[model samples]
Target: MSTPSRFKKDKEIIAEYESQVKEIRAQLVEQQKCLEQQTEMRVQLLQDLQDFFRKKSEIEMEYSRNLEKLAERFMAKTRSTKDHQQYKKDQNLLSPVNCWYLLLNQVRRESKDHATLSEIYLNNVIMRFMQISEDSTRMFKKSKEISFQLHEDLMKVLNELYTVMKTYHMYHAESISAESKLKEAEKQEEKQIGRSGDPVFHIRLEERHQRRSSVKKIEKMKEKRQAKYSENKLKSIKARNEYLLTLEATNASVFKYYIHDLSDLIDCCDLGYHASLNRALRTYLSAEYNLETSRHEGLDIIENAVDSLEPRSDKQRFMEMYPTAFCPPMKFEFQSHMGDEVCQVTAQQTVQAELMLRYQQLQSRLATLKIENEEVKKTTEATLQTIQDMVTIEDYDVSECFQHSRSTESVKSTVSETYLSKPSIAKRRANQQETEQFYFMKFREYLEGSNLITKLQAKHDLLQRTLGEGHRAEYMTTRPPNLPPKPQKHRKPRPRSQCSAKLFNGDLESFIKDSGQVIPLIVESCIRFINLYGLQHQGIFRVSGSQVEVNDIKNSFERGENPLADDQSNHDINSVAGVLKLYFRGLENPVFPKERFNDLISCIRIDNLYERALHIRKLLLTLPRSVLIVMRYLFAFLNHLSQYSDENMMDPYNLAICFGPTLMPVPDIQDQVSCQAHVNEIIKTIIIHHEAIFPDVKELDGPVYEKCMAGDDYCDSPYSEHGTLEEVDQDASTEPHTSEDV
Candidate 1:
């Protein structure tokens, strides 16, 4: 016994197999469609992102431009008048104004970052997205085409299998028919032989011969039929074998398609598409992240500037700038009428009498104010109690009281009717309550007024007493002996310079000489610390340090102490940078002397790079030896800093913007405002071409130089001690005399 076939017929098997193939094809199509749809969506998403960033960048650019214009306009307006000079002198005002300027610059920087982000999205990110989408689409199409061809090939094989199966069935039916005919012919021949043996009918020799001939013909026919059956059977077996082989081949192809080929196609389409999308999205995210980081850095700079503003410092600066305006007025003297006879203004008796009288007046006023204050305090307490009682009345349960009244009304109907008839009574009660509340509020207001009056009286008394004491001190004291006025002697006034006690605001050359170094200790320490710790810190110089900390560090340097020698980990990088900036800003003569400001500006404006660099080198060589050496050291550090611009975001241009004014201050005049851009450009050019502008000198290198370069404690370098001062003086003598020299 054999197991029954699962399928009833070959047609059913073939139909089921074709159905599976169709399903697989449909699945492949669906997968391709899904991939295409995802690709389209990703492309659309990228496009939207691009548009968003572009518009955002436009907004940022416009906003930044407007802010820059606003700052420039205000700065111009301020610089056009004497107030600008006053602001420069007044440290308090200068700080906030500088902060405002810095704020505007930071915003402009952020806007530029946003604009850059927009450009990246449009030029780089979007282009990559488009390319990825194209590749994905192309891949999907190619996969789809391959899948369709594979399905077509499978269908052809299936069709051939069906044809083979049909031919096998035809041959099998012919063979069955031939075998039936042969069996029937053999049965007829048996029937004829039986009739001859039974003798049931007349048996002649001719009849027997006819019967034998019939039997012979039947046998011949049977033999021929048997031969045909055999032939049909062999053909049927051949057709069956062909059908089986075709079916097996088709099965293998289908199996391989479903297990390997289809999966590979799907993976190709899906994985590649997803991978490309992932990469594109990651790129966008990275760009966005960097943009936001830059924006935050800019904001931090603005915040630091705002935090460093000092109102007290500004006030002190105001006083310092306008000393005459803050001078004490002369003491008042008693003036007598021309016809009147009165004591001299310095008479002790008259002064004593006036002081006693003022003291009495203040004492009387103070007593009266005390009494009034007591009265107002009591009244205020009474008013507060009344208000509290009113609040309690408002919180009473009127509904419960009404129910009790109704219950009593039923018991005393005649009394209730009489009470209801007198509605004016209830109205009178409500009016009384309102009157009491009004009185309470009025009492509170009166108490407040009385308290205010008492306070004013007390203050008046205090002021009167103070004035009396001041007058007594002024007039009751013995006057100094009057002497004849000395004859006026005209003498030349001495020119003002920085105070000798502090390190800052002094001559840079003097400081260099004192320190016995080519670079000041403060500058060298700051640069070294920044290089060591701040290479990756964003917005190093742009962000301000704590004013208190900066001042502390500055004081340390001024006091001949190395503040940075202590644990550097606790030192803020911005604070060090701030100290450095302050050192430059406080120089009596900027690193680039004021006389050569125009020359430096002109050098930067030259069109040809080689010519500009040549002129810059010449101008730099003309600087005092100390100034030139320091500039070289500073510019070298700045150049090195700019190399890490990607991390610190302090490129040469940004650094120049921060340091330009400090190194080459514009004269406090209206004409130099337009030259500020050139000044910044000059500084930028120097920073970029520092090697060319300030070539290394062999004589400058020493143990101190190495120490400075290595971020060690500052020591006297060889240039300072090796007869360099005479050369510096000679260089200075050649330049036109400026106010700084005085």
Candidate 2:
């Protein structure tokens, strides 16, 4: 049991120590393998990244160069071309071309920024990754070397312990064998003495001597064997002691390798590699972030430049640059050739008669062409109808042929039907052909007639212009007769006859007399109501009130009852305004009478502000006394209303547009469309220059003056703030009057 235990213990100790060492070596090998693999992966990845960045840098640089070249090419082209240069100079920075330049520049800048980003990746981020990979690989190699050295050392210690253990076991077995031999020798010697002493065993002297010798030899051998056994035992003890010490040292070394050395090597390998990789990744991310931020900033600048473009300003700039090109052409004047007639009557009559004759001839030609064109048009339409009928019959024949083909009729029958249809089809086609020819001829006739008519119309217009010029020339040469003033017979006012007789369409003078106020009752009511409430109403006069409400209010005014007198809330402000506008529009005679419309409109054409105002004033004073008083009163109210233009959006211009035609309608004989704008301008001028145009009613010796002298409400005239009555009278007396109305 002891021997077996000894052998088993020695084998177990060696086997355990070898197994631990092998496991440690295997773990170190695995770590080294892992570190190598990671290093290889990192290197490959970094190489790939560097290659990508290098290519990206190249692309970005090339792109930037291309953008720069493109911009330069266009810019050079523009600079070299005369028209482009002129346009650039004219429009300056506000032009679309300038905006395009800015856009191109921004694009170039963006390209450059991308190039910079690429450079950053190539020079900084990629390089950093390369450094990290290189550093990690180097670290991996160093760590692997150290691990191998540690494992080797541990293996050496384990091998030495194994050798020592084997030697000890061998020595122990030898000692046991030597000890067994010594015991056997002693036992054999004892047995021989017993045999010799036995009676049955006779021994001679020689035999006795040999036996003694044998015994002696046996003892001596025993002694010798005992000595060998002692020596072997001592050797085995020494070997065992050596083996234990080696085993202890080997275990301690292996434990230290696993707990300290291996851990340190693995940590060193992984920490540096991971840290490098982390830094490289962070740098890459930061580079991308910075590139995006720069790109966004560039895009913002480009967008703002694009948004700032204005084509209208460009056109205006061009106009400013080339003023002479946009200037009006020189006006044409009549020129007399050499040897022109000196006789006034005959020469003028001859020119007039020739123009009249030419005009009449062009007119007659135009009439004949128009009649011919109409006849041709009718003939063409009739011919087109005949062609349509022919086409319809052809379509029916074609469909009938198609039906005959689809049916199971015999080929002979089909052919016969086709033959039978062919003739009629030909006849129809011939008819269609003739009808088409007739239609085309009529169309040609119509076109010719239209062209002739256009030519004759142009001739007629030219002749008319010539005749107009001749007449104008004659009128310019002749002096206008100073006709005596026609007597204006005053008519007696008629009393109101019926309730339906509206006050709005009545004579202004009759209404003024009936109201007994310089400003009519309706006008005063509307103005007062608007000034009180509707002053802040948006689009005061531009927005119309309900027709029903306006009519009702108008009837109330005509019934001699003030619909807007009290409880103003019952009447819509717009309705009251409508009533006022309706009254002015329905006037038998406008405030600026029709007779004076031309004179009033002409005043607006005067260039000088002071003279235009004086002209307007003179013309306004020529109005009948009742009309002039109402005009002054109405204009004063309008001027006051315009003061609140900000709230009502009814400045003098807007008010003028609303009341221009109402107060001074264009005459029937005049081109109302052409003169409407002039009428509005005159009204705007009167409203704006009311202080300068119309005198204060208090200064006037008329119905308004009597009312003002009585200290009436109308006495607070719009122009009363200008000067005293004496000053106004002096200024008025100095002014010239064309009629006794003033």
Candidate 3:
């Protein structure tokens, strides 16, 4: 009851409580150690089992390989005694290979009347089934040795796995108990500490006057300590729960590895039995119950193991236990579970995917826009260049518009000065006169021999008559009227072939189809000519004409032979005629205009041949794109073909002879001389030196023809505006627009 006695008693009581707390802590520590040991053992057992199964699979593979080799040797020794091919064919009869299981199905139809068969036949049947028996027996014996060892190792691993799992659960439960007892001991310590009165609280029961306040303080202190103790207990409980969860997860993992390894071992056993068991064929054929039962038990064990390892909880219970641990619902599922945060998340994902797709489409469109912008820029540059070239050409004086400009004039003068200066001009003039006399003599003789003089005169008169009624009488005076023209010899033109050249006129298409080999051959020649000289020209020049012509020729030849067999030599001539028709049809301006037909014919009777040639050149140059392209390649084609005329196919003269009437469309000639003269003059001038007819860079550049000819408003617009060279005399009458005016 005294102060020292009470103090001593309190100390002793505190010591006893402390000892109990220490013992509880010691028990918890021991349980923790046991749990750790069990975890380590379980891990070791799973690892060992994995190694065992892997080794068993390897051994089974080796055993099967040995069996295969033995079967192969037995099959070789027991091959049928027949011809080599027949023996080779029958050798697979009982080949003891694993994949040959399907082949064994042939045995089902074997004769069951063995009782009626001779002794030799029955013996052969016995030999066929048991042919490889000894080798199989030896292989099976070796497999049995391996199987026994594998089975023992597998049993040992399973036993260890079971024992370790059992020990782990036991220690896990003990650890939970120890943790609870430790919590209780800590509570008891807190109660004792409250009774003993700590320095921090400073409450004493011995102060009688202040006893109520002291009691209240003591009660407060006790309550505070109890609350603090309860919190610490909660922390301990959480720690214990976490530890148990970790252990349970470890157990689940160990169980999975065990079942997987065990399943592999079972598979290996089944393979060995099928491949290397004693009497395996008999066992398989008979559907042996004992082996099947064993396999069924092993599969059942696997199923049970999987079920036991699966963590068990109803849907509601799982949600209560770990509400946030599950995977989020799919986007569609969120629709049914509407008004949840998941719907918002799903919407965000869908929006992100759509945004990504849109972003890719935008990138592709931007790339295409860049390409289109580049093409537009290039085309604009080309158009500007074409306009500038046109302005330069149009700057020439109207009187000499067809003539070369001052720059080209200076070049011609310089060349003339170099070769024929003032001093030598007289001497050169004398030599040119003599050469002219000789040329005229040769021309007169050639004209007399060919008998075309009268025909030329008649053709001239015919051209005059066809010139339109008002002009026909005015132009008829110069013609020689006495000559009678020969009767025309013409082939009935074939119907046009259905060709892909849709732009061609009917006359052009028909001529090309009739010409056959000649058209393709000329197309090849034209292609070669353009590739050499017309490289800078645009439009169809960019086309691979030579290749196209060759392909067309090859295709046409494949379909049938040329139709112009009776007139093979004339085929080339007809082809030239067809080409001319194509040139006329393609022109935006007709070569022989329907409106100005008489005016163009009047130019042929002009006094000076050079002036007349210039007038005709101007007329031809009035034709837009198609004429220029045709003139360039046609000149080259005729020039190229003229050299090969010795073969009797076609020359420039023959082409001119054939095409003049076709191109001009003059009336029937009364005088043969006039007809021949008109025909020869055109053929010699236009087809040979075509560049002389269309000499301007403005003519060659594409825009003038494309813009002026193809436009719908060509008639109302001037030549400068619409690209058609209309009313040259009217233009010359006005003050011509200089390049600056343009």
Candidate 4:
């Protein structure tokens, strides 16, 4: 019982514990391998089920298609004398034929002889194929679900095994540390007392150490045993959980699959109940092509038999038997020729009556013209008399001056005419300056003759009398209580009044006349058209065929064609609108500059209407002379157009909306459409109150091109005026351009 023996015992116990732990690890490895194998087997089974389902579905689909083709081919065949061999050969397709026969019989039993055979066969085949496909899919899906459940169970078991392995390692490490401590204690005792029989004290110490060491070994073994037991329990629990999961998944799969199978079978039976009857009918019809021919032959034979009857009684009986088979005899009517003659006579008489009516109307119109001539003569005379009254012509006789003229010699004439050379400054100032002396003499004569002295004396006396008082009398006389005050006229000062009328003029016709420029005939026509129709319709009516109208206007003006051609059909509202749009756009500067549109809108919100109008005037003045001239006419034209009632009355607001986009610069039509309302408000404010808004502006008085050619300073605009307009005019004039070019 020395130190060496205790150390040896500790070593033996450590070895036993290590071996036990190793055995437990080996068992865990074997269980894991078994679980892995089972998982692989389940996965393979699921995969096999899927492949079987796919194959079955494909086979069923192919069989259904084949059955359909088989039925159609059999029905389409000509069973002629030469087709018996072919019919026999077609029997090789026994699968479809057998299916057809089974479906036919099933329909007969179920339908109680109410269904056709061929249709029933087809329906049954299709329904059976769909049912089988659905069943196989359901079975495969159930198997797959079971496999998934098993996999989850295995995963849980593996996780628990990992936990057990970790715990075992922890316990093993503790046991190893205990053994090492026991070994160290023994080693230290041996170093202190090496011989077994050294002393009783030494021996007692050694024996006590051995006993303590043995107790420690026993305790370590007990702890190892307990750890092993815990590991085993964990394994057992994992196995039990896995079994329970598997059992539940199996039960669920079985229940769902069977339930689905039963339902699908019932659905197939219920939905395909008429299949057999439909099949029988189709088969019967396929064999009945000669029935129609036989019916017609029977009708013909009956007709021949009826024709052989001689007695009237027999004929009546035959006709009654076949009421719809005979044709009724025709009866001729003799009135057809007389009816034709009457229709011709009526047509001729109507034509003669229309001619007579037209002749009488023309004669009446001629008589009206003669009466109109007499009225016109009276109107002319009255117009002349009115002119004479309004404007007077005076007669002046200059015969006396002409008669008094005398002849003179050149020297005498020169001396008489040069008499002013003898005059001095004093004499010139004092000697009766003709105008001053004459007026002065006349004033003295008038004062002396009209009792002026007496009136002066009386006025002096009255003033003295009035001044002698406290001035109450003077106040009474000077300030009369009963007199009314005169109203003074308030005049707003105009900034520029080069050429303007006294009144606020909206007459566009006067503007055209005052312009003194030859506007194209088409342009005038377009204006008329716009005023006539555009005011009524707003944006609805456009000047149709603008290109042609522009071309015609250009041609007529440039080529000296008749400006007042009677045919005005070439001009329309749209064409006029286009021309106006072009007039603005063709300027050296756009009237509504794109960058300034928003700024103009901001200016419109100014509280003072005059200031806002002034801002708008400044914006308009910034445009080229050509643009201003067109804009002036356009404003007047719109003013005239707006004078109407009800529906035809186009206000400034509608006019602005109609032309805002057409006149202004926009990125696109879509932006224009969106901004139209804003444009309408702004333009309406400017145009309706243009006289106030643009108080100092005036329309150009001549053709814009002529002004450009003359190098007028005012024609300059922000866009620059470098004779581009002059060049354009020259090009337009020289070339045979159409109105469209304008």
Candidate 5:
């Protein structure tokens, strides 16, 4: 009963449960009704996203607007500063931080108004931009240099294209003309048609006429095609011409012209004034920065220019215009002829009076000197005779005493100090025989050329006598019982005399070399000039131009330097040796010992001078790199010389340094200026030559051309290079090719 009844009941229950679930679900779904909460929550989330995006966009827009405003204001500042008074003073760009504090204190005491500050936006931008501006300008310097080269290349490319296109058009025209003639040679003909490897049919008379007509139509069609080609080519040519014009305009506008007027209050002034003003303005701006100051002036300038500018119609023409209305012309008046004449007359009178008095005094002094010199010669001869007689008697006595003195401690050797021992077998074998010839050649050079020498005898005579056999006796005869012995000369023999001498002498000749085996006369002159200028101990003075005076050198040496330290003596030795070699082309002879100079002066050999110079040239040509190293010596020498009473400094008047395959030997005795002009002319020619031929090393072309650009400042000229010419220029009169102004 349970199983049957449960089955029927379960079916009834399942059907009723299904119906109830559907009614429950339908009632539950229909009961939900409030939309406001869901709508409001979704709307809030969407509003938050929208508001975030809007704020971000507004911030970005504001930032961009501010940046543009800053750029415009900066441009305006640059433009205004172009004319300002403080544009170029260049001390500290920014004042010390404390400076503004001091300024504020003073301002506060003077008045109640507080220091004005720029707006936050403008001040902040300016501070950032100043750092950026300096960096940008420096970085752009390289770009600007590169731009110049680019512009030059562009011009070349454009020119080449124009030429190639012209040639192509001409060739095309000729080819078309030839083709037209060929068209006439091509014609149509009728022939018998027969079957051969194919089936063939002959046309009727009317058909043959049609074939001929077809050929005529083809000829006409070819002509039409040719005409069409010509029209298309014409269009291309027009387009190309328009393109060229557009290119020219674009090139013109690529650069900007910044016009800067002189400050309003300043009258006609020099470039120096402008540069000073620019530096000063930069300094003030760097110093006067304030966070809160208003940039109204800068804004106003930008706004005015923006409002005033009109859209350009002729861009090419506008860019071509230069910044012309800047500095004004200064007025000057020429001195009258009579006024100039009077000035010259006065100068002449003063000069003549001085010269006349000098001449008279000189004549009187010459006469007196002649008498004194004669007496001195006589006295010298008499003293020599007495010395010879005394030496003979002293030798006799010494010889007799030598037997006794050999056992004692007082043997005098006066003869050894003055005489050199004859060459012995040991001495001869010590060095190569070739060194003797070299030595003889060098010795002959000394005989020919006059160089200064420091006499060892003059330096050590007192030491020698006091320490020799006569010293104790002279002391015994003169000493007052208990006087202490004085300090004696201490000798320091060193590596300098041997090692430095070898190192320096090895490259001595080579440093003076020029482009080739044969040094030019101008180079020779320069070498001589350097020699005379550097060797102040020699009886030579660098007067002006390349001329020197012997007497001045004597006076300077006679007024010798203070007691020299050992290092100083070596320096003097090296200077003398190096300097002399520059002139005579032999180091040893130039820095000869005083004993050596004495031997030369006592003899004569003029022919040896030329030989030494030639030999030196050969020596130098053998080594190249050492030449530059030694030339630095010339720079050092120029630095050391003192100025003369009649001079500003002692150095070369001018020089043209050559770096390329040096051009040399313009025939004739043309002076330094003419030589300079000739070299400059050659450089210009090389620069203008096809770059395809020379390549980029042509900057080597610079020195020769720019030689004339070198000024007195670079050379340490001894006098004004103005209207005044050297008195030594007179020597050039005999030299026919030399200029009066030399």
Candidate 6:
């Protein structure tokens, strides 16, 4: 029996099998990997199912919340002016904490006692409860309304999504597809983890789809569905316009951003994304749920515009009059305390006046002293002839010393004066002359008539006098010196309806009740930034003129410049009145800063002030070029600025923004230099191919354009909106069916 008579049969061959352990181990490892793959697939499916069920639970919570609101009405009606505690009990049912507890408890019960720390069921339960919590967060504030029909509609969408998910696995002609993908992902994972052992830990995997045709069919099906959805969405938008407008207090921004971004509405008149969806839902809701689609929409734009002119139309009047409540924080008193304390420009003017007056006074006194000295000199001349032998007066050099002192005081002043002041005046005068000659482009709204201009000038002069005293920016000029200022019939200063400008002086009575009262410093800084970006346009969401109030006055000085600091006068008030020139003399293509802003555009052409101003004005008049330019410009500007700051090691304006995939979290000056060069080169190339787009914009002056391929290929989003050829190829590699709304 010694080892079965020492290897006789082929099956029992035991001539010291050479390392069959390694082969056996290899087979076991393969089997292990297969098991892991199946496990992962199951886990993924279960997770998806849980997410769907969680959504359903959320719908339940929403329905319950709505019921509570309905019950509140009933409770209020039934309380015959008595029984406070009972009424409180009814209200408690709606309390967010209680609602959340009930929702979670229901989930726990539904989970069949299988709840554990890592339990999928428990996680689902928790997710549903969290959604309910969001709804009940602040009773007075409305949560996202998930209506019954909407829930049903979302359920339908989930079913569709599941169908597509299932199709992915079945679509593969060969079962090896999922396996292949798993292998690929595992390979990537391995590369990342830096593991080189013979796969000691087998990863979970699933059957992979191997057929390319199956993938194409799935993609085609998805495209067909998406197209149908788009059509339905479009119909829904037109139908639900009224409904959307009605929810103005809530839906305005959402409606604009979500829809307009996805469509061409920014250029042509069209419906938004949600509106289209709502339209499709209209007939369905009306037919099935008896929902009135018309109930939600506010007055349409045309009606709103007409209503605005009607001062008595309580909505507009109430809003304008009560401005504080509409904004926020209701701290008018605090704002008043913070505003216009420095009034640098105004103060500087006062200082200039005082200095002038002092000089005049000194001149008069000096003249008198000279006359007295000369008279004394005449008499002394006769006396000096006799005293020449006695005194021997030495020659004096006082004049030279006085001149030297005067020149020294003005040394620092010269550079700023010559560069900033003289340049601005010469440039502005030229622009004014240009505007005077050209008439088609006058801001017709501001120019009523020549007579009005005269009156405006008179008012401006009076305004100047009021501002000149004590550096007070808040004070309106005392009523124009009425030389019976022949009021050739006052036409009312561009009725409050016309002027978009903010009140320079605080209308404390008006803004005291606003709910969104931002600090004056924040307001001022934002305004300055906006103004720096462009000044012709008023600020966004701003009620006050904090930025404008900060002028080239003595109080507004640089950090280490004591003389300027003590006085607060550095920037000239009118220096930046017109557009700044930006030239792009490069080789790429013409792109420029023009659109997507609600206000002043800073696009420039390196010459002519009014031309520059008019050019910028025309720029944002519409969404110019294409979405590509807009996306490119914004990305470049943000990335460049972010990188430039990083290189300098300065704190970022918004550090969280650096987390985006395309974001260079801490891009430095190197990125900036590279980006800048690329942009410049594009401009040059565009000039060469000037005939392509802006055929009229000749080679004499180049146009600004955003350049990607800068910053070491920032196109890493793996998706494409404004994309390069390489980026598009990468995007195509990701099957659209597998992608989410992101």
**lDDT of candidate 2 at residue 630, scale 0 to 100:** 73
Q: Where does candidate 1 stray beyond 4 Å? A: 1-43, 77-101, 196-202, 294-742
Q: After superposition, how far is residue 625 of candidate 6 from its true place, in Å?
A: 17
Best by TM-score: 1
Q: How big is the positional error of residue 448 in model 6, measured in Å on the Cα after superposition?
A: 36
The C-alpha local distance difference test score for the whole of candidate 1 amounts to 0.56
Candidate 3 per-residue C-alpha lDDT over 1-742 given as tens digits, one digit per residue, 9 for 90 to 100: 4446644654564455346435433433443343234334434544453344445435534553454455455445544434324545654443444234322221111111111121112222222223223323332333344334433443443344334433433443344445455566566656655654645345545553354455566556556656655555444333332232233333333333222322222222222122211222222212222212456655565444433321112222322333222212111111110111221111133243443343344334444554554555465445434423321221111111112332301112011122224565356445534443343333323322222222222223332332335544443342233211211111222223533322222233333345432233333433333323332232221122333333333234223333333322322332323333344434333334445445455665775545665777777666544434545545545544443344433444555555455455544332332444464556545554444565655546521112122224323322123111233223322522111100
Give per-residue lDDT, candidate 1, residue 696: 72
Candidate of highest lDDT: 2
Candidate 3 vs candidate 4, lDDT winner: 4
Per-residue lDDT over 225-254 for candidate 6, one digit per residue giving the tens place of the 0 to 100 score: 555555543333222221211212122222
List the candidate numbers ranked by lDDT, top first. Answer: 2, 1, 4, 3, 5, 6
Candidate 5 weakest lDDT stretch, 10 residues: 257-266
**What does candidate 2's lDDT look like per residue over 398-449, in tens digits?**
1121122322112221111332356864675467556655655565465446
Sorted by TM-score, highest first, which candidate order results?
Answer: 1, 2, 4, 3, 5, 6
lDDT, residue 324, candidate 6: 32
Q: Which candidate, 2 or 6, would have the higher lDDT against the true structure?
A: 2
1-742 in candidate 5: lDDT tens per residue? 2446644654564455346434433322221111122223334543453444345435544654454455445444643552322434542334543364334333332121111112111222233223223322332333233333433433443344344334433443444444454454343211221112233266577866666676666567667656655654444333333233322322222211111111100111111122222222232232222211376466456444433322121111222332122212111111111111211111133233443343344334444554554555465445434422321221111111112222212223122111123464235324323342343333323311211111111112222232445443543454332222221111112222222222112223332232121222223323334334333432222122111222222122222221222222222323333223333332332222223322222222223323322332333333333332233223223323322212432222211122111222232233332244444322222221112112122322111111112223324444223221122223222322211111
- Taken over the whole model, the C-alpha lDDT of each candidate is 0.56, 0.59, 0.36, 0.39, 0.30, 0.29
Superior by lDDT: candidate 1 or candidate 5:
1
* Each model's total of backbone clashes: 1, 0, 21, 22, 16, 51
Encode model 4's per-residue lDDT on 21-64: one tens digit a residue. Answer: 35434443443343334335434544554455445445544554
